[model samples]
Target: MSIIGTIYEDVTTDVLGHIGSWQWLVTFISATLMVPSMLNQYEDMFLLEPPREIECDVSASSSVFNTSLCTYSVLNGTKVYKCTTWHVKFLWMIWFKKSWLIFCDHKIKLLSTTIICRLGLVFGCIIFGLIADSFGRKLAISIDVVAELGFRLILTFCDSESWFLLLIFLRSLFASANIYMGIILTCEIASSSWRTLLNAVVSIPRMLSAVCLVPLANVAPNSETFNFIACIFSASLLILLRWTPESPQWLLYNRGIPKAEKTILRAAKING
Candidate 1:
């Protein structure tokens, strides 16, 4: 809990200190490290003895993952299926709640979610890439962010398991699309030569978040709070709208120079 409190405070301070750069640095680093392996660094340290419950925990997590994956897929694209939202929310509760309060709850489910989160993230990025190329970076960013926000809000308020499940499905659905979208969209905003470097830099946060920052999740009280932390992280990235712009490619292709200039300038300032 202390760890999470410190990180939570640090995130706030990081945001205030570097509206454009440092905050994003943290974001980039964490997002770059967005794999389960990053946070598992210490499991071997303190809990190395491998508690007896670990086996049961692993088994349960696997089962939940398998089951939920199906549930999420079925309802994610279907807005009419209300149960989808509930399951999604439930996953957050299971993940962030870290409930010793429920079935085999310890680090198992959290670890599983952390593991799967970025897998979903990877797919999300790819989907966004397509959107950016087809629909335009600005539109992709806006749509992804809005959908992300809506999912978070819905999950945050949902009280029932059914509601939470649906929320989780919605969040994961969009998030899977968002990870790649952020990547392709940001790249579109940069200069051609610089695109590679900036795009690479943007990926740094997934790593940092996963490795250096995510363990703090262990310090948080529950899944709900963790979801909020993740939400804040996502929102911070979205707030880049003040500085973000439609990719110059789209502008160039569309033959809009004056329009592309400002976005180019901002990218240069931040990324240069």
Candidate 2:
């Protein structure tokens, strides 16, 4: 067996011989607290998109304007006037439209921002995966959570489209890291018998987070207020993570058997 595998076996056999309360506690906390982070990250796709139905009014022309087109022709003339304002249906105040002024002409730019933010999910997995292996799962999750919250809060105040897109990209990047590393830590700390069940439990929050957003969006006055409420949830997760224990598997491989043993004992104490 490899070094980590050997250490994992020893810790599971000699120290954490059976599933205990500490394992269950970690599983529940991680699963519950993760919902907010998942919602905050995944909601970007919905929020970045412009409302489906839009109509434009021309100030100087009495022509019938096509809702699909960005510009319209006058009744008796060939002059095409650009739409300066839009009448949007469904969601009237999405931050993407209000803050950036991304009308029909700027649909491409809106799509680009959505694509860029989503790309963070792919990169965050690869990058934070390495960080988890090298540093420790606990540290990796903590750093990502802090970064995610910081970027999200900063994004609320951003006025420029370029800066807003950049913040959303970075926010998504770290938000993914928080979830990825959190799952890793949860699995690493859990016993082999409990691993599959805990993983399933953790995944439930992802679906629930999406459901939760429906109510949140309806209650909040605007997109900025909605974002602020989401950030509050992220902040609460940070606090909960403080009591969470590091993975004995990671400590054994990186910090030697003594440290790993210490962590196991501490968890045992908590379990008792």
Candidate 3:
């Protein structure tokens, strides 16, 4: 009776922390290690003795990763900490509140969605590529970004699992298409000598964003927050497009000399 009573007391005290710790814990475990085989460094230390769980100090953490590492070291081995299931912080919770395992209660369904999204990309690339070639890069970009933004906004309000899946497919389609149109525009606008430099310059922001995403996610941890951010960015691009002209090369190739020449003159005047 004494042992059971003590165990129950401990369990009641520890339950809240475990439940709330998921957000930071998942983030830390997902971070890329400087050393891929981080466990190797502690091989000597862990060879004879496995570590026991120590109390995590939350006060010293600058980010979730720090908090997670402080909570438990990898040296403790899998037995001390194991993620049976995961949670997605932020707007992801609105739809996926129960489990990150996702709907249909099977891993295969999740895998199928990923496969479908990838296939959607293939069709998106081919279809949007031709659209950009047939119409203009500016128009294609505007169409694709607007569609993607709309889908993301719709996703926030979606409750039905089937509709959510469909929306994801649509978002993937538009996202892939937008990427193709963006690449086309970049290559079409830059001179041959400056093409490489233009590509590199444009890629820098994407790379920086990719690097900072996890940390930013820690701060803004909602799917809705990111969706809003994307919508604002897309809207800003639309506003900026008002001042920009259609690709002169696209006009020269697809339209006629007169229209292309007019666009160039307008652009030159704007620049001056």
Candidate 4:
């Protein structure tokens, strides 16, 4: 099948955040961002006609009606009729109407968007591991989520489109810490016998996260609602961080002896 025409994505659930998980967080971050990423493209599926066409000239506006699908238009009519299932490309087109927003809002804040646009790719590096070493992967992931939550909250206030994109970039940064990288880190320290199996489970959440946003998208199904959902997911990810174990390997390598021992003890108590 042509990748371009694909309409829906498969959904699955397998979230795994380890005490020092890196991969899961990276995936989760990307998945979480994916919700808005695609949704941001939803505005263009339809088109419309002016009322004068309906009152005096159906033939004149014939081309406009036939030209688009899932659109909204008036042919000298009082109310607008939105077509069902507007094509998605139009969303990007509409944004350009205010293309100035791209530069005005945080969307193009130079370095930030460049750095953030690749949360999935970038987190594959050693940075997540370092975060795990200094802050405990769990805590580090938690912090990143919190920051993203705030990024979303503040994002709503931005009138500029450019700045909003910038905000999205920053949010992705935090997501990078909690998503795929976090998951990979967890699998690394999980029981070796079950590592691959559990790693597969970790990947599931990344998949599920997309579908989870579906109902959310349907509920309000608007840009504002979608952004709100993004923030909620970020916060939820942060809170769940407590359930994660501190990476024993991370502890052993960086803190040694007692701290590593305490980490194990802490895991027992939490699990118990």
Candidate 5:
């Protein structure tokens, strides 16, 4: 896409933010932020420090099922337990050792963050749905932006598994709401003929953001830096919102014809 194409898409996305394209980027970053939490699954399996030579006394155990009866020891008189040194390529699980997955290899812990994220999506939809209905699309998006940024900022400094999980849930909730609200606003505001093109254009950013995650994770020094980057990107949207206008349709329906007409007229003047 050319600079003009990028500008067009961005302008279109902001215009549609009340109804459509802007949320595509929100969804992308939101989903990207949550991905780091699940990195522990890979870390637990592949990134742990290698254990020293192990001496297992299984000769005393006659049953194959009774592995508990077997006694094991480290040849160097040191116990090989949870990993202290991470693979370094993954780079950040060391900060999260107090979390449940750090001490034990539980399958439930592996799935918990993903599961919580889904739960947040469900809750976010329900909550933001009502908010958009009661307030207006622009206000709803503003709230989502703030919530996502604040939670992500907090997530950067978070150490506990519970706090990390909670922040992700909160952040994803806003993410889901932002996507839903943005799509609705776009669909509501754009002409019926132009809707498809707007949606396709916005989706490009979402795909690019998804592809950037691997490099983002690899290049970031730690979870804090990773989250800080997300916060900065999210904060930039606030500046972008200055160019985004309120939805005339929403204004008409909720604030009456006068406000709606004024907004429409202002938009026309800006476009002209």
Candidate 6:
């Protein structure tokens, strides 16, 4: 066939055929970075308003009622009256509890925020897929990391409910895009024999990251602290990216033989 095709075939057969340091390093970094991205995307679930004891005052009568649900309370036995003043006992200061007074009347709005965040995931996949194909996997991942970090930082300081919703959507959008891009890059660089195994291994970190959220939430004093810690963890990926190489397969198709050859040689040297 063509010169590029021959070189690509040789590289795939020779260099990638062996499981080596370069391949393992890339997979480890990519998988580890997925932790913060996932935490940022789904932290809202953990931050949802916890059940609270609510004491409501009845306007017409002197009777006060205590309930967990902030809806109407029975006064004597048959008379149901709407709650006027709310005495809410918060177990912890979370995003939902501190902001967006999501009582019984406004619980639907909280659900809407989660739905909007999920919608962002759908859009992120489509948009970033186009970006990865058009530009490059590395560029797409870099953009996703930076954008997710920026949105999350802003979200930490967000007080307004409207802004919080918007930031949640944007944050999840970019965070999720990195997941697929990382997977694609890893698979593209891996040997055929190792692809399935590497894919499964890489996914393990994602599950571990989800589990980590429990300790992270408990350790942080509040939602802002949780987000700040997540940001700090995410920032380390920037340094890791310095050692991360572009996919040689992508270079072969998009950037021609020379670029791909250089990457393959670098990987070989590192692997050696």
Top candidate by lDDT: 6
What local lDDT score does residue 133 receive in model 4, on the 0 to 100 scale? Answer: 60
Question: Quick one: how many clashes does candidate 2 have?
Answer: 0
The segments of candidate 1 whose C-alpha lies over 4 angstroms from its true place after superposition are: 1-127, 189-196, 233-238, 254-258, 261-272
lDDT of 1 by residue, 129-207 (tens): 6766666766765665666656665555455644544454445545454344445544433333444666676666455
Q: Could you tell me how far off, in angstroms, the CA of residue 265 lies in candidate 2 after the best superposition?
A: 0.5
Worst 10 residues of 2 by lDDT: 90-99
Model 6 per-residue lDDT tens digits across residues 1-272: 01223355556558655588888988887787566656754445554444334344344454545443444655576655554454433333332223333344466776787789888888888888887777677787788778767886787666577788888888778777666666777787777678778777778766766666566555544456567667777777788778777777777777667877888888888877
Residue pairs clashing in model 5 are: 18-185, 19-182, 19-183, 19-184, 19-185, 19-186, 20-182, 20-183, 20-186
Candidate 4 shows a clash count of 53
lDDT of 6 at 272: 76
- Residue-wise lDDT of candidate 2 within 98-186, one digit each (tens)? 32334343667767877887787778777778877887777767877788678767865565667877787787777666565556667
TM-score of each: 0.50, 0.75, 0.58, 0.53, 0.64, 0.75
Q: Each candidate's lDDT (Cα)?
A: 0.44, 0.65, 0.45, 0.44, 0.51, 0.66
Q: Which stretches of candidate 6 lie over 4 Å from their true place?
A: 1-10, 47-105, 209-221
TM-score, candidate 3, is 0.58
Cα displacement (angstroms), candidate 4, residue 77, comes to: 18
Cα lDDT tens digits for candidate 3, 18-37: 22232122212212111111
Off by over 4 Å in 3: 1-105
Worst 10 residues of 3 by lDDT: 32-41
